[model samples]
Target: MLTKAAFALLLTLTPFFALAEQAIQSQHSCFKGPFETYQGWVMRMASTLKKFDQEVFSAYFPESKFQQVQQTLDCVDFVYQVDGFNVEGYYLKPKLAVDKKLPVVMFNRGGNGRGGYVTFTRKLTFQAELAAQGFIVIGSQYRGASKHIDNNGFDEFGGADVNDVVALMDIIKQIPDVDSENIAMMGWSRGSMQSYLAVKRLPNIKTLIAVAGVSDVHQGMAERPVMEKVYKKRIPDYENNKQQELDKRSVAKWAHELPANMPILLLHGDKDERVNVAHSTRLAGILESLEHPHKLVIYPGDNHGLTKHRQEMISEVVGWLNTYLH
Candidate 1:
């Protein structure tokens, strides 16, 4: 027999499950926004996820990337409060002469462990390229990295990750130099999911970019044998809760909900070993079917991070942002 709360929970989750089954059936279908539930609690939870994502983003990145914008390039450390936790991140802003009002670029790093480190900031060797082009680059950090515990909660802080970028934008608006209207976000791997989903929920974003990000976590895990091994090592029953969490975190499922006219770019490598190229391939199909404004670029002989053509990737990313953001 189910308790009252358990019964209520079931009722709340019923639509999502039904929708998931429908999605699986179609193999290719349009993603609609969240269905209104009669249960107020569930609605509150979804609303909270969106608000929490925004607040956590604000609290985690409270200031500009640099403590002093004396040099042409510098990384600044900041903190934002999320669910009572202090989430830390690095802000990388470019200082241009004559005080240029630069477009803002948000960086979402890869992996659950990756954070505001300079090394993982992508090998886009043109670190100063964005600045040269007059853009304020913000590198955000999600939960479970650097003093934060692993987010074992359902949805894996997916909505909260979206909030982080939005909050960062809030911080930028307060800054003296950055142009709030021309803002874009780009992420690789885990960070790509964060950026992609954030844009879906919040369409105020002007530009979007994802690199080597998987459309479905289950498919991604299936393709990468090492990830399965990793899951098994960490949790003997990886198929249990981990699967649930990944489903909640995947961006491919939610990207279609994004507004139709937003400029979005997808980049992937053919020979990637970590995350399959199918992630982007499948995503492109969804975007095309939905008739969304998006461009998918496939690179040959590139790996997980697009390391083979790092410079080319950066040039393209900066170029994309320039077209939309600038």
Candidate 2:
């Protein structure tokens, strides 16, 4: 008694039902911690060319058709200790194992103090996407994130925060089957500044991905007056010697210090308002002048997070990690 239309509708609904079943069956924590864990299916969303052209594209896009896509991944939360404080972080692994020796990517979060903490949803989506590609992904909540326990109350911008990432390497070493030698890093916004500083300290890192990063602290202070206030508040000697403190954080002033052979991929959105595209462009020029290995890609009409070209940006990141980290 079922018509052809009914049959098609049933077929369309079948996968969702199966997904629901799997969601129930796979509902178990993969990692337990003093940190909370989020493990379940997550909808994967991406923007299209039309959305980008409209200049209305944002990470908060709710109108995109791609939001209907029901791809999901498993996620877990855990904690790693740094400097005698229990720092919160997440460890994500693919549902299916591709290799016993899985590559690792340390995701550096953006913002300062409590502004940049990676939440449960981001751990399940953005971090899980990389994990689904067969890489073990980890991220830090760092020292001063909101609601963080054992707070040391130090927000070093790119200074001690870089050590937090370096300490993660020790955690990575303990992770079973993780290829600690093939480690890579991805940083967005303020996280990019942390990545720049981390690469200098950790020579084991194979490749660097800097997205909407701050390359020049002095330039950033100049571009955004509020940054000057932030610097003065965070850096103790900012009032006495601003340039010296700025120079400590500015990668543009010390491109020569980065590992000469290590490759860096810089991604920026031309329409980025938080951190200007000029940050990446200026660093590209400096790297080129220094003959350091680097690549710079600019997405037109995209914002600080490269929200318009989400899929392309993810693809490029995976490709770069595949080429360099694997």
Using lDDT, give the best candidate's number.
Answer: 2
- Model 2 steric clash total: 0
Model 1 lDDT per residue over 1-326, tens place: 34667546644532212222211111110111221211232344346555545344435323242112223544444455455444555545554454557777787777653333334212122344565556767765664455533431212335455565556655666544667888887877767777867776667788788888867877877776666654454333456778666666675666667767887788999998877889888888888888888899999999986878877888898888878875
Off by over 4 Å in 2: 1-74
Give a tens-digit lDDT track for model 2, residues 1-326: 34667546644532211222211111123322321221111121223123332223233433232222123333544544566665666677654445468899999999887777786546645776788787988877776674646554477677676777887776667555678889998899989888888888888789999999999988887789898777876776668987787898888988899987889999999999899999999999999999999999999999997879988999999999999976
- lDDT at 158 for candidate 2? 73
Those runs of model 1 whose alpha carbons end farther than 4 Å from true positions after fitting are: 1-70, 114-127, 148-162, 225-244
Clashing pairs in 1: 53-160, 53-163, 54-163, 57-164, 59-80, 59-81, 60-80, 65-76, 65-91
Best by TM-score: 2
Error of 1 at 204 (Å): 1.1
Query: What lDDT does model 1 reach?
Result: 0.60
